[model samples]
Target: MHYDVFNGDADGIIALLQLRLAEPKSAQLVTGVKRDIQLLDSLNLNSQDSLTVLDISMSSNQQGLANALQAGADVFYVDHHKAGDIPSHANLNAHIDLDAETCTALIVDALLQRRFHLWAITAAYGDNLLSKADTLALQAGLSQQQAAQLQELGTLINYNGYGEDVEDLHFHPAELFQKLLAYDDPFAVIADKHSPYYILKEAYAVDMTLAQSLVASYQDSQLSVFILPDTSSSRRVSGVYGNWLANQAPNHAHLVLTLNSQQDYTVSLRAPLTNKQGAGELCSQFASGGGREAAGGINHLPKASLELLIQSVSDYYQVTASST
Candidate 1:
């Protein structure tokens, strides 16, 4: 038996698509929303079975993966996440890269060459490598309009993965994959006048509208914070809100904090476009979160420590602004 495990978002789906197009294998797909990492543990892989994992964090499934490898399962793991102490095993083939600018789709595209390269570009755009995706699109002979439409599709799909649960999402990531797989090329799918693209566009518009209206903005000299409502809608749209806040107040670094179901907060930090780095490290100092220098997030922050966390973030912003 062979299993294909991936993140359910555009990057993961597109990465697996490229692999399938190149290798042409029959494998079961295991995936969830953007936050659902370490999906390999749920599967039952035998000693002779092969597992292909893509766009998921190795650290989250380290122990289960080690056990799988020890059981003689052949594992080909490809991801771009913070990996800690990868195990060495003859059955394990790991391709883990933690470059902030690179995503799994781009990595697979590089490994597989131009085969399904347009899908790779869409995944890259979904992952927010807009400039890189545009450049690659040109190289792949995509007209400017075509590239932009693909970019929008990627962004929309990525946006669909943001909600607190499947209910909050535009469509389940797996269902989105089913729709995507129906078309050979995403460009063709998006260009069709009566395609799923129109459905996704309407959903995006509704979500963006709710996101824009829910922001509670506060500013002090150099620091700004947007306290979002504690709702599924807010959780689903936090990242987009953060980006909008950052752009609107280009002079101030923005913090977006929303309450989750557990009464804890999920926080996303973005440095000013001017200083586009170090928010990850700052968040990691006081909570469980880490990402590239430009952007990062904390999964669950206790409500008791919310004030302290905000103070620390504000202090860091002031200190950094002062030093610069």
Candidate 2:
């Protein structure tokens, strides 16, 4: 059996979508909420099996990847994250770019020679690489209106991927991916009234409204932190809302923490847009935390550690900001 394992977010979904569209494959789908990265461990592999992994960190799945290789499963992995050390194996094919400006979908787009350029642009938008996406859209000769449409579509698709679990999402990642498979162009999805775009758009508006009403729990010169209640809306909106905050204050780092069922915080950290570095490293300092340089997350942050997190983030960014 073959499995297509990916992150449930826009970057992951669009990366796989481009690949499957370029070369249609009938493979078992494996994915989960945006924060659910350790997906490889769940599958038991064998010599006859093959896997395609996208948009997930190699460091977090090192053991599962080693097991897959030992089990003789052919693997193709692509990502843009903090990859500690890549394993050298005959059956493993890895394409990793730690560049903050790039994402898995863009990498896939390059590999596919931009056969699905618009989709990649949308993924970039969804991943909150607004400037990069805008540049790409302009380079592709897209009109202002056309680019805006893709950005909105990407945002909505990305918004659906957040949540504590599948239950909190508007559509399960797999189901959303399947629904999206019907359209080669993202514009088609936006144009189709019955498409997931409409549902996600409406849901996104509601969530964003609630998130916007929240004031910063902690705010300083270099950093701002918002603490959200333990609601499905908070879980579903935290990441994107963090992105929104970062965009609003491009010079200040932002942290959005949502109270989870475990009574701990699910943390989303975004490095200042001007200094897109160190978020992953900062989050990695705590347990259940890791991510890319520009954006990172901690699945569980204890209440006692909250002050420490705020301090660490503020100090790190303060130094970085001063140096620059």
Candidate 3:
């Protein structure tokens, strides 16, 4: 048996898309909403099973990976997250790059010698690696207009993954991937009018309009925080909204907090693009919070701790901003 396990975000979907397009294969697909990273836990591997894991952290799935290895599964892992110690077993192959600028799709692009380079660029854009995507698009000889179209496509696809669950999302990531796979080129998806790209684009416009009306709960020279009411719109827009805010003020950190079912807050934090460090560390100070240096979140922060979180975030940026 063969299994393909990946994160349900643009980077994971595009990474798998490039691989499958290059080497057609039949594998049981495993994926979830953007935050569902511990994918290997749900699988039952056997000695003969071949598993391909992408875009998720090995550290989060360390136990599952160990059990898979013990079961004699041959695993291929590719990621750009904070991987703890990786197993060196002959059955395990890991390609992990911690470079702040890299994403799983780009890593796959390097291995594929850019056979699907444009798709990789689209994934980079989707992952919010804007500067990198711009460089790759130009290097691929895409005209300015063509590159802009690709960026918009990437952003829409990315926006669809922000929801709390499949119920909150417009299309399940797997379904979206299947629809997208029909078109080898992202441009074709955009042209199809009936494609997921168009659906996502229309939906994204409405959500962003609602989000833009929200005023920041806290704002200063170094940090700006917005606490959104727990609505489907808030859940759907939080991640992309953070990206938009970060881009709008590259010199200031941005935090988007949404009230969750438990009456606590789900926090999304983005460090200044000018100094994309300390976000993960700052977020990690709270339980259920941690991510890459540039972006991160706290899954459940008590309302009582809101003031503490706000102060820590402000202090983190103050120190880091001065150093930068």
| lDDT tens digits, residue span 44-77, model 2 | 9999999999999999999999999999999999
Question: Distance (Å) between predicted and true CA of 76, model 3?
Answer: 0.9
In model 1, how large is the Cα lDDT of residue 252? 78
Distance from true location, Cα of 149 in model 3, Å: 0.9
Q: What's the lDDT of the predicted structure labeled candidate 2?
A: 0.95
Clashing pairs in 2: none
How do the residues 1-324 of candidate 1 rate in per-residue lDDT, one tens digit apiece? 888888877788888878876777877768876767758778766798889988877877887798788778899988886667888888888888776667898889888876778888998887766667888889888999999888888877777777666787777777777677767688788778777678878867776787676535666776677777777767666776676677687667777888788878888887765665577677766656755455667877887977777777678778877787
lDDT for 104 in candidate 1 is 90
User: Which structure among the candidates has the greatest lDDT?
Assistant: 2
Cα-based RMSD of the predictions, in order? 2.8, 0.6, 1.2
| Candidate 3 clashing pairs, residues 3+ apart or interchain | none
The candidate maximizing TM-score is 2
Candidate 1 residues lying further than 4 Å off, grouped into runs, are 214-216, 220-223, 243-253, 271-276, 279-288, 312-324
**Candidate 3 colliding pairs, count:** 0
Clashes of 2: 0
The C-alpha stretches of model 2 lying farther than 4 A from their native spots are: none
Please give the CA lDDT of all the candidate structures: 0.76, 0.95, 0.88
102 Cα displacement, candidate 2 (Å)? 0.5
